[model samples]
Target chain A: MTRILVSEVGPRDGLQSIKQVMPLEAKKAWIAAEAAAGVQEIEVGSFVPPALLPQMADTAELVAFARTLPGLNVVALVPNAKGAARAVEAGVHGMSIPFSMSETHSIRNVRKDHPAMLAEIRAVAEIASAGGVHFAVGLSTAFGCTLEGAVSEDAVVHLAEAAAEAGAQEFSLSDTTGYADPAQVRRLIRKVRGAVGDMLTSLHLHNTRGLGLANALAGLDEGITTLDASLGGLGGCPYAPGASGNLVTEDLVLMLNAMGLDTGINLEKLLEVRTILRDALPDEPLYGFTPDAGPMLDYNERIAK
Target chain B: MTRILVSEVGPRDGLQSIKQVMPLEAKKAWIAAEAAAGVQEIEVGSFVPPALLPQMADTAELVAFARTLPGLNVVALVPNAKGAARAVEAGVHGMSIPFSMSETHSIRNVRKDHPAMLAEIRAVAEIASAGGVHFAVGLSTAFGCTLEGAVSEDAVVHLAEAAAEAGAQEFSLSDTTGYADPAQVRRLIRKVRGAVGDMLTSLHLHNTRGLGLANALAGLDEGITTLDASLGGLGGCPYAPGASGNLVTEDLVLMLNAMGLDTGINLEKLLEVRTILRDALPDEPLYGFTPDAGPMLDYNERIAK
Candidate 1:
């Protein structure tokens, strides 16, 4: 079986967008259930101020809990050096720092411009490396920005190069506003890979434009291994108007598994995990076609055969 | 711009699944508005029994109305020689006859077995050819079937060859149950094309599994030009439990336009047409991401630039 890594981001990304806050215990349960379903890694929480996002207040605790799971890599989203410090202290397996390519979104999201963000990347990389944590810089709004409009591809590639040079272990390009299409996905992945080579690690895409899986397929065709997805299609950027949410993990796994690529996920178990989310976040709407349509009859038959 | 054909099938495929019957005038207005938005072809209706599907009782009228529009290819779904005769007399540019590869789905959908369906194909093809109407065979359950599990690739290719031999001007494979994945799509298209060559003309896919557009992109990558979609993702098989509907047109055009593929659609105008459907079929739910999230800021920016 050809292996692909599916990194779950529902706890952090999905929770951050919604108004309802899940209890810390429920978060642990969700992570445990998903990890049991064969998710190798998960972004358990964000190291942001509780004042800005009360939803992520339990991120550190969640990370600690996530670490207890065998064979599971725990990750956290750190906005800057302070967040990085917290993440490193928490002893996470990986930390992702988002670097918005759009200057306006950069300021709006992290209160920093490109130069300032680059400095932060270097600072966090040093802290994470010293603490023996893997560091990745996510290029948010690399496809396009709602606030700043079109983000140039050259600028995205330049920032990827800069983040790599700043000592980051890996880089990811995000469709922060779900502006990515397959051609752009192919073009940008090829462009960035050409510029930074092995430094490009994963893709963070949204289904906001209904191209999430299409974009993921495009990434896979270009040899990308890691995919950032939120279980139940959990998160949406409250800041980005009209953005739906991240690619639903169940649907992504279904596509990958059907294509004969091994995600190592037991999809039936993954879907069962959605019940935990539903029970914890009762009012929140969960989205995915597989759940709605049920598994393909023939796919199930093939498995039985 | 590189060109691709997006054929609308809402009238025949979408309306057939809904119980609410749309008035003839509303149907006309709907088709007219889509044509004005630059849809090159519209499957106006199916020639099935009025009692079986009263929603499509106006198919012949719809086809006649569709022909009044300049540069638009009017199509109708014909289940047998009777439907084909009506389509021929109605003067449609094309007629699609579905040939199910699954034995069970073949019986359930059209009440005919493989041999019987093939014979119908020959009779319809002869009638259509004499009338100068292009005849295409749609291989339903080409991917898999709810009634019959695990449709074979070899069976699908063999059926395509049979349809062509029976005088089909073109052949199409449909994921009637939305069982297609990108890898399966690539493999099946290659296999079928190797068997039927240039006779393969279109793909009829569903978003039932949320892999609709991804599957379409896979088809495009394999050199498929014509895609069958429904405005607002209308239509679902009442018999096929849990299936969603056809691929949404606006979302499909948005991805195509962003990839620099010329769909020749004015998306703005296309979205406006949704209002007509909404008003006419107020109770029917509409689906598509581009309409919800709006166009990509960069894509619109590029259009402006």
Candidate 2:
């Protein structure tokens, strides 16, 4: 089976939902632990203003530290042209601009509509290109939006194509509000992949509707090889922060491994990272099935003796 | 999308595991309520002796009562020739015999080895054939057996063929001790299906390994249509008594419906059935997800005008 890359966004996505701010050292430790657990990419933190999201304030420090780890792709979430400049200056592998496809969510999340955000994405791409940093447009609410109700597939395709035209090296669809069903997922992904064939198609899905793994499977059927998952399934949008925002990384990794697909992630090692993270933020309600349920019949046994 | 059949087996498989016998009326009410909840087929009760399982002592009466309901395929579990004869005489729409592939489980469960059990199946088939009753042989321990470890794929295929030769109309593979991983499930189902292609392949899985839904998806991918689930995941082998067994019906139904595969069972009516069942066994643990997590975004909007 061709291996799939799982980007653990727990530190960035999972921690941001949590009220407590993990120490910069603890964040670095978590990143190292995750990299050792075979996580290829780690979205260490977001580049929003510290005043807005104190939890992600140490993003630059964490990213700089993460870059020292060999073979680790450190990506950061940049909200606009300013954050994109910071990510470029930090010299990470890639930076993602949150491109909201829903008009309402775009106005609420980034205070800009689709066309204006596309302009920012184009500028971010130019800045990243100048610095030789990869640019990925993370399109949030490609699935339906809670604020806007149902997001159009036409809107999603149009945004993805716009990002590609704006010089984005890659594109990923996020189920920010998690209203995606598998059929809609399959339909939208096919449309987007057709619009941007080889410019790196990926998905960032949430299990809000309990369809994270199902949506991932649909994307897989559409030839999407990269998937975004948060450890313990964390992350709540400021407007609607809840337990349903991001897909839990441990559960997603478990599904892929159980499907006989190599994810380079040892579930045992990955599960341990949750504990390390929990120690820093004890009140965080960590979510995942495989972690709490334990391994499916001695996954450790096969790995052990 | 073909509306997949989800046969609720909580009353029979789920309740039988506990020490307390939900009174005869409770079993009848559970059957009627689940039928009212749009569950098309249900294994209402097993025809085992009251001496062996006092919890299901009133199964015969429940079966007779369930038969009066409109459009319900009431099924009963028959461990040996005696139970099958009793179920057929009681006028059930379907009668299923548990044929353990493991010599150890067969010896423990029914006191008959594989071939001897084949003789018993043929005996029941002859008895049911005369009465024009539908017969299904569930290949219990088709995936590894707890007592007799590593049940060979050939042994499972052999039992499936034996049951078919003995004149059974339907076949299902159980994750008896919940040892099935999806890859293993896919392999065994393929082998069994190749042995009896399109011979009414069903899946009887457990959440003991926390991979029940994942295993169900594997079965669906392999073309096994019918899924057996217990409401609230109330199940454990009554052979030991007072322990939980079987996958939760609520979780399983939610998973299938979420994946866009239509299961005729309604989530709301299913929850209502649980309430009525709760009156019978107040302290008994009834498990399910859709009940706990509420409906998905605009579930009623999706359902209503």
Candidate 3:
């Protein structure tokens, strides 16, 4: 069976973009249900300051709850050494740090330039390494930047090499502004892998331009094993106007299973988990096409017989 | 330059699915605007009786008006020999006859089984050939049918062979119910091409499961030149409940352009045409991510510079 790992990031990425806070109990239930649906790994929450993002204020608590689930790799998002320290103490299996490729976006989002962010990544890697936890540096705006019109390919490859050298276990290319196309995706993934080799691990994509799944397929064609997606496409970029949230996990799983690659996810069960999310964040608009149209009859038959 | 043919089917496919009828003048303006935006082919309307689909009643008149536009291929959707005769009289550049692969869908849609549909296709081809107009047989539900659980690959290839033998100058496979996955698309296109060679001309896909553009890209990879799409994703399958309309022309063009393939379409002008569509059919929802998020700045720069 061709296996692919779908890393769920709704708790951190999804909740951070929304205004409403999902209560702690609902968050726990959501994570448990998703794991039960066969999601192997999940980014439970982000270790950001409560004042900056109250929605993710319960990250430490959520991580503690998620770790109790059997056979689940509980992950968290960290911005700096402080966040990484908190994540390591919380005993997360892995922690991801965002490193922006665009100079303008880097300053606007995290108030740090490239070199400063690289130093922060190195510090976070050191902290996570001391705790014996896995570390991944997410290359944000790796495709293109909203503020800085075009992000250079060389800049991205250079950063991947730098991050790998900084003791980062893995690097993930994120279409932070959703400007990625399939050709660009294939080109960048090949370029990064050539530079950093096995250190380039995953892709975090947004459907902002409707190329999310297409771009994901390009990554798959390049033998990418890990993908970051959210349930119901939960998060939108608050800073980038009209950008969509992460690729919908349900849709991604459906496409993978249909392609005969094993995601080990029961799509029907995964869709059922959407109700829990909807109940927790009632006003948030959920977006996905598979749940609406249901699976293809042929796909259901192939799996059944 | 890599060129792609984007065949606009919004008038026939889009208007047919909706309940509200767009006025004749508005339909003409919509076609004219799209043609001006560099869309080469326009499916101006269908030849079905006005009583069956009142929205397409002006198809003959629209085709007449569309033919006057220089370099624009004025196409019409025909159901049988009668429709083909009318289409030929209208001086259409091309006429497409839909031949449903699923028996249940064929009867429900046009009251004809495969054999009967093939006979009609023969008749229509004869009429079209006599008039010096091109004829394409659209294989509806070529992916899978909602009523007929699984459409076998063998069944699709068999029909393509028979259609080629029966005198269809072109055979366009359509995912009428939107059940196609990328792997399935690549598999089927390769199978059909192997069987019929150049007889397979285009792909008509739906974004019902949000895989429209993905499937289209798969077809493109197989060197299938033509693609059928609707402006703003205007059409839906009335029979297939919850199935989305055709692939959005604007989004498809954006993807093609981003991949460095040229469709000769002006994205900004195509968007402006959406306003006319919106004004004419105010209640209808226009779907596409490009119009919402706008094109990538890098894509704009690459195209400009």
Candidate 4:
């Protein structure tokens, strides 16, 4: 069976966009439940300043709690070297920094231009390497940008080369604006792979325009292994304007398992974890069709049969 | 440009599952607006008995009105020889009949088993041939059925062959219960084609599990051309329990156009058509991401750039 790494980014990304912070206990329960459900990787939190995003203020605590789960790959987002240092100190297994492909978006998001962001990535790579942590640079807005519009494919390839040269261990192409389609996904993945070889293995996609799963399918066709998704697709990035939730984790897992790919996720158990979020964040709307519709009637039979 | 035939099925499929009967004028307006938006084909309505589905009672009237539009290939669903005769009299450019792959679903949907359904297909095919109306057989529940779990792929291929032998001019695989995944879609399309050759050209998928577009992408990968979608994913078949809605047309067209495929659909004009359905069916809910989020910022540049 083909195995795909489904990286859960709900606790960090999903909570980041919400107005109220998820209670720490609820966060711990969500992470533990997901880990128990065979989700091996979880982006527990971001090491950003608490002042800018209070919802992520409890990220370090989440990291610590998630790390206790055996076989769980605890990961966090680090926007700069300062955040990278904090994440390393938090003892995260992996750290990813968003490298916006659009210079305009890069400045607005991290308050750094391309050169400065590259330097920061270098600095973070050094810190993560020293701390024995896996570090990845996420090419955010790689598809297109709302602020700048039409981000160039050449620029994305060039930046991947630069980031790889800057000591980035792995790369993730992010459709932060949900502007990606399957055709672009297939073409871009091949182009970036041409630049950085097999380092480009992950994809961070959005469903704002309803092509998230389709784009992920394209990524899979190009041999992308790790896919980032939020439980219920609850989060839209604050920095990416008009962006909606990341691909719904439940839906993505459902499709993966249905395709006879082993995601190691027991979908029913993963679904139960949603109740914690529901009770904790009562007003927040959870999104995903598989959860609403439940698994297909012949869930065990698989789609191929 | 890779021209894709986006056959709008909202008038027939969308209305079939709804509770309230749409006014004839509203249906006319919806069909006309979509045609004006450059949609070349539309399944105007079903020719079922009015008592069974009053929502489709206006199918003949719709076919008459839709045929008036230049370049519009007006179509309707005919469940039996009687309905097929009526569809022929109504002068539809095309007519389709649903042939459920699962016998349980077939019995429940149309009160016909495989052998009986084959007879019905032969009778309707003769009528369609005599009347010079283009006829298609939609292999409903080809993916899997709610009534029966794990529909055999061999069964689907066999039915397509049987239908073809019965004079089905063309064949379409329908995910009536939305159990299809991308891998299964690619596999089944190839298998059915092995049995029926290139005559299997269209896909009628449901978005129940959020894999609708992904499955469509898989079909596209296999060179399947025509895609069936509803205007807003508004209707689902009342017969196919647990089935939600057909693939949303607005989102599908947006993805197709974004991928640089010529769908001939002016998305902005297509979005305008939703207002007619919204106003005419005040209580009905409209579903689609592109309409809710509008098109991407760089909608014109296409994803490849």
Candidate 5:
């Protein structure tokens, strides 16, 4: 059976987009439950300053807690070498940084342009390698940007090549604005892989336009091995109100499991993990079709059956 | 550009699933607006008895109204020869009968077994041929069923062969319970096509499991051109509450339009059509991610770009 890595991103991407800060204990429980449900990797939090995103204030603590779980690969997002050092000190298994393909979005999001972002990626790579941590560069807004509109595939390929040359071990095309379609995904994956080879291994997708899973399938067709998703479709894009931001992890897992691909995750236990989120953030709306519809009849017996 | 036929089924499939009967005028206005937006085909309604589905009582009137649109191909669903006769008299461009693959679903949905349904298909095919109307057989529950889990691909292929031999002009694999995945869709489309050849041309998919668009993409990859969708995913499955039913036309068109496929739909105008449904069925909820998120930045310019 072909194995696909479902890297849970609810803790970092999902929580940062929402204003509510889940209690630290709740975050720990959420991560623990997901790990127990056979999630092999989790982006537990980001190393961003608490003042900007209080929801991610517990990153170091989460790293500490998640490391105790056997076989769980803990990941954290970093903005630059400064944050990368903190993540490494906290002993995360992997660290990733956002290098926006749209220069305008980059300036607005991280106050850096192409050159400065590459420099940061270089510096972060050095720190991560020294600490024996896996490093990945996420090309945010690689699809299309709200501020800049259509991003060219050539530009995405160029940035990915630069990041790889700058010592980044892996790269992901991030659909920050949910502007990607299946054709674009296939074309971009092939284009980026042409530029960076096997380093282009992951896709960070959004369900904003309801094409998230289809886009993921396209990536899979192009041999992408890792997929990023949130527990629920939480952490919606601030630019697009009433739109789901992250692809719901449960929905993605259901599709993967139904396809008979080895995702390692158990559907029932993964679904049960949602209750922890529900209790932690009562007012926040959770999104996913599988959770609402329940699984197909005899779902357990049908996984990769 | 590859032209794909996106057949709108909101007037029939969507309405029948919901309790509220959309005012007839609203339905006519909706169809007219969609046709004006460059939608070429629409399943106006089903020719069921008024007492059984009062919601579809005005199907003949809808067919008549829709046929008047210069470029619109008006279609209707029929249960058997009796309904097909009414549809042909109403001057429909096409009429389709549901031939369920699962015996349980066949008996429950249309009160007919395989032999009885094939006889009905034969009768309908004769009437359709006499009237010079296109006839299609929708293999309902071609995917798994609520009562019977994991439907066999061999059974579906066998049924498609029988339907074609019974004079059915075209066939569609219907995921009535939304128990379809991309792998199953790709595999079944191939298997059924091997038996029925080009007669297997359409897919009637549901979004009950949120794999609707992904499944549609798989069908497109397998050379199936015609896809059935509802405006706003209005007609939800009765068995799965809080889960969307039919593939949302707005979302599907958005994906197709983004992939540069020629769906001939002006998405801006298509999104506006949701208002008619919103007004007509005030109490019922509408489902779709595109309408809620609005279109991607510069979406109009991005169509088939």
Candidate 6:
């Protein structure tokens, strides 16, 4: 396929960064709108505990609602075996468990060590296989870590191979702290892709360093077919202070379509989805260039088959 | 110099599109504050008649005031040979006269045909030579024309060569209607650079097509050094309802700086200039990303020499 599928992660990745927590039904509406916009897959919610991340407590309900959509693939983030069990039982199309390469980052983000994370990946994979849900491992800090600094690409590639061996069917590289440049991105992605082979490799990038889209472009140039973006530039990193984490979905789709790549997403309808999220979280800021710039006169319309 | 010059043209290109005319003195203050922010070059006003463009009556006075600033390259837009003469007399560092290759755009904008417009460029060149001032030619509608549609790349390359031959020290490609894409930009820039070499370079782009930054990135990849932007994403063609012209200067510079391309601009200081423009033209809308999303903490300190 010439068109790469752009999966929006605003509700899950974007919402938790900001202080505002969207209600469950409002999230369902947001997911429904994004589904209508032809977003092939969406990370609907995270399965983090309510005490830890109050913003994403409605994962079970939201995933079930998203699954009802005809062609939409519902995805969820699971931190450990418990969240993985919930995601698999809730019937999400795909489940991703994060593995931070940096030992320090693993402790800070998940309260687990590297070996514990690897064991948890095996647990999540077992749950996914039994429940018939897709299993993947997201290697955050695959490029560089904010806490420790200078994550080697060798460790990242080694981790991907480890996750695959642990029964993870897919692999993804994320620039968790956004320290990636285009050159670094090309080098790392090439290395990772070569290691992972064709296990549906993808990227989950944050725009913390403002290299989000540029790094994403590098990934695309390296033959990556799956990209994760938030509707607005809603990266919302806690350490980042008033910044959106993921690259802006609208801007990324615009870039892909304008380059003659088939995204199968309508620019106008996708922007309309922004209004749905805006209504739900009125205080949270939404960001993207294309919506503000408006669609070009010849923006191709998308037919949701 | 390795530093690229990003000239802000919002007060002129941006305000002229609005029905309301921003006060002349406020316009001057905007330029002044922008210069203070280390915006070395600012297109303070356009040299159009008061009846046609009542928004910019005090351009000559603005140019004079802008010249008073230490180490700033003050610029003005000259529509024809007459505006060039005034700009030369006012003693601005540089001025640009827009030449539309599209016959329909030329007729609608300046009420002249292509051959006659060629005569006007010759006149402006002679005036600049006598008055001892620098003159550049901006070929507007170089990408495509709204009225005539699908402007030929050959036509743009030829006009660029002719402008350079007629004593234009610098030439800027105008995507007056924002009809440029990245691949198209790489192709056309390569074609023009082949024809006119370094003399035919610089980009005056619009984000109307949502491809402004992408087109700019493509231009940079092709070794383009100078970029023209308006402050606050201001400016549109009054005749063309939805057509905004000129990429937002602050946002574009932010992208370049974040990419480690030195533009000799401090983002925080550049952001301060937006407030002056916003206060001056309360009725006019200004657009920029970096202003809303504050600059990275060590950004200026890290980049500063």
Best by lDDT: 4
lDDT of 6 by residue, B1-305 (tens): 35777878776788788777777777777777777777878888888887888888888888889999999998888888888877888888888898887888898878899888888888888888888777888888877676765677788888888777777878888888776666567777888888888876688888874467667777876788888888778887665445675687877877777556778777777777777766766776766556655553233332231
**Alpha-carbon TM-score of each model against the true structure:** 0.97, 0.91, 0.97, 0.98, 0.96, 0.82
Clashing pairs in 3: B235-B245
What ranking of all candidate models by TM-score puts the best one first? Answer: 4, 1, 3, 5, 2, 6
Off by over 4 Å in 3: A298-305, B300-305
- What tens-digit string does per-residue lDDT give for candidate 5 at B75-155? 999998999999999999999998888888778767888899989999999999999999999988888877666676787
Candidate 4 has which clashing residue pairs, if any?
A: none
- lDDT tens digits, residue span A1-305, model 3: 78999999998888888998899999999999999999999999999899999998899998899989999999999989999999999989999998988888889888999899889988998998899999998999888888877788888889888888888899899998888898888888998999998788799999998889999988988888999999999996666656667899999998888888888889999999999998989999998998888776646574342
User: What's the best-to-worst order under DockQ?
Assistant: 4, 1, 5, 3, 2, 6
- Against the true two-chain complex, what DockQ does each candidate achieve? 0.68, 0.34, 0.59, 0.75, 0.61, 0.18
Ten contiguous residues with the weakest lDDT in model 5 chain B: B296-305
Per-residue accuracy of model 5 over A1-305 as CA lDDT, tens digit each: 89999999999888887777899999999999999999999999999888878888889999999999999999999988999999999999999999989898888878899999999999999998999999999988888888877887788888899899999999999998899999889988998999999999999999989999999999999999999999988885554334357999999999998888899999999999999999989988998899777676453443323
RMSD of 2: 3.3
Task: Give the C-alpha lDDT of model 5.
Answer: 0.89
Query: Each candidate: what lDDT?
Result: 0.89, 0.79, 0.88, 0.91, 0.89, 0.77
Would candidate 2 be rated incorrect, acceptable, medium or high by CAPRI criteria?
A: acceptable
Error of 1 at B31 (Å): 0.7
3 against 6, candidate with superior DockQ: 3
Q: Which residue pairs collide in model 1, if any? A: A14-A235
Give lDDT: candidate 6, residue B27.
79
Q: Ten-residue segment with the worst summed lDDT in candidate 2 chain A?
A: A296-305
Best by DockQ: 4
Over the full model, what C-alpha lDDT does candidate 3 score relative to the true structure? 0.88
- CAPRI rating of model 5: medium
lDDT of 1 by residue, B1-305 (tens): 66899999999889988888999999999999999999999999999888999998888888888899999999999999999999999989999998988888778777899999999999999999899999999988788877776788888888888888888889888988888888888888899999899788789999998999999999999999999999999996666555558999999999888888989899999999999999999999999988878766545564343
Interface RMSD of each: 2.3, 4.8, 2.3, 1.7, 2.8, 6.8
* TM-scores, chain B, all models: 0.97, 0.94, 0.97, 0.98, 0.95, 0.93
